[model samples]
Target: MSTAVATRSGARRIRLDVRLLVLALVMAGAVGYLMYTGLQGTAASYFVTVSELQARASEVDGRRVRVGGDVVTGSIVRGGPGEPIHFRIGDGTSELEVVYSGVLPDIFAEGRHVIVEGLYRNGQPVQADSVLTQCPSRFEAAPTASSS
Candidate 1:
């Protein structure tokens, strides 16, 4: 009888150990999946200038990116009250056409520096999701008169 009791206890211990091991594996897998998804969500979008985008056109086509350039003078065309606006952006030697269907910022205008976030369509124009304009003098301090 004593030998029988010892055998049963050993069996129970083995079962408990197996259960614990399975639980640990499941928890580890869950943690790994969470980490992978977090990293994917936090991936940074590519940022480039108009000229750089032109140089890498083949590589960046159809990918979401942020391009910075000056709005070309005489290129802004506003549609009716609720229509999309079309414009051209340029970086000195290169240029890109952009189409955005959103309300224009009060500061958005021709010749202003702007950053456009969107997908570049091959052989077409940039399908802009958002447009951002920089303040002309946000970091500049007021000029001070020199006291001789």
Candidate 2:
């Protein structure tokens, strides 16, 4: 009788250990799922320059992005109200037109460094939600015209 009771107690202990292991596995799985969802929600790709953008345009469209390039010499066009500014950004190989509605930075100008953030539709230029320009210094001197 004593031997039988000892065996029963040992079996009960083994069953309890198995239940605890299952609970641990369930908890770990739940934590892993939450982590995966959180990472997916915040995933995004970084933007590139005009050349890089053109190369990856198909894959980048409809996704959030930030692109930067030099402003083209003769592509700036200012509009009114809803359409504040329009300009083309270039990286030699390709160019992209950007439309910005909000107030522009003081340094925003032609032939300057610009970074525009937005989405592209079809083959047309991407409309920008934000535009940043790198302007030249005011202390810089302009070249004087030479008389012939």
Candidate 3:
């Protein structure tokens, strides 16, 4: 009788340990899944200059990127609403052609710095899905002292 009771207790302990391990694994999986989804939803992109983008064009071909540069003068060709807007952005040393089709911001214009987000293919213009213009830090001019 003593041997039978000892065997039964040991079996129960083993079953309980197995159940606890399975529960822990399930909880870990749930936490991992939540983290992955949370990060994917709020992923942020960093800016790359036109020169940097061109230098690495081969490696980043067809990949999504955000390119920042000043819009080249006389390079903005605005189309009617809902049409494609063509422009070139240059980072002093290099230029990247861009094409965007959407409602442009009110402040968007030639000569303003812009950040374009889209797919880039080597030897081709960037097909931009979004264009964001950089606003100037000084909205008002500094007050000057009048000569006495």
The Cα RMSD of model 2 versus the native structure comes to 6.8
**Which one wins by TM-score: 1 or 2?**
1
Residue pairs in candidate 2 whose N, alpha carbon or C atoms collide under 3 angstroms:
none
Per-residue CA lDDT of candidate 2, range 76-126, in tens? 898867766888999877888887788888888778888898877648778
TM-scores for all candidates: the values are 0.67, 0.60, 0.69
Q: Cα RMSD (Å) per model?
A: 3.8, 6.8, 3.7
- Model 1: per-residue Cα lDDT over 22-101, one tens digit each: 99999999999999998887774446899899888899888987899999999999899878899999999998999999
Each model's lDDT: 0.90, 0.83, 0.92
Candidate 2 segments exceeding 4 Å error = 1-47, 135-148
Candidate 1, which segments miss by more than 4 Å at Cα?
62-66, 69-75, 90-93, 104-115, 132-140, 143-148
For model 1, which pairs clash? none
Q: In terms of lDDT, which candidate is stronger, 1 or 3? A: 3
Instruction: Tell me the lDDT of candidate 3.
Output: 0.92
**Model 2 TM-score relative to the real fold:** 0.60
Error of 3 at 63 (Å): 4.5
Q: For model 1, what is the error of residue 146's alpha carbon versus the real structure, in angstroms, after optimal superposition? A: 7.7
**Per-residue lDDT value at 121 in model 2:** 65
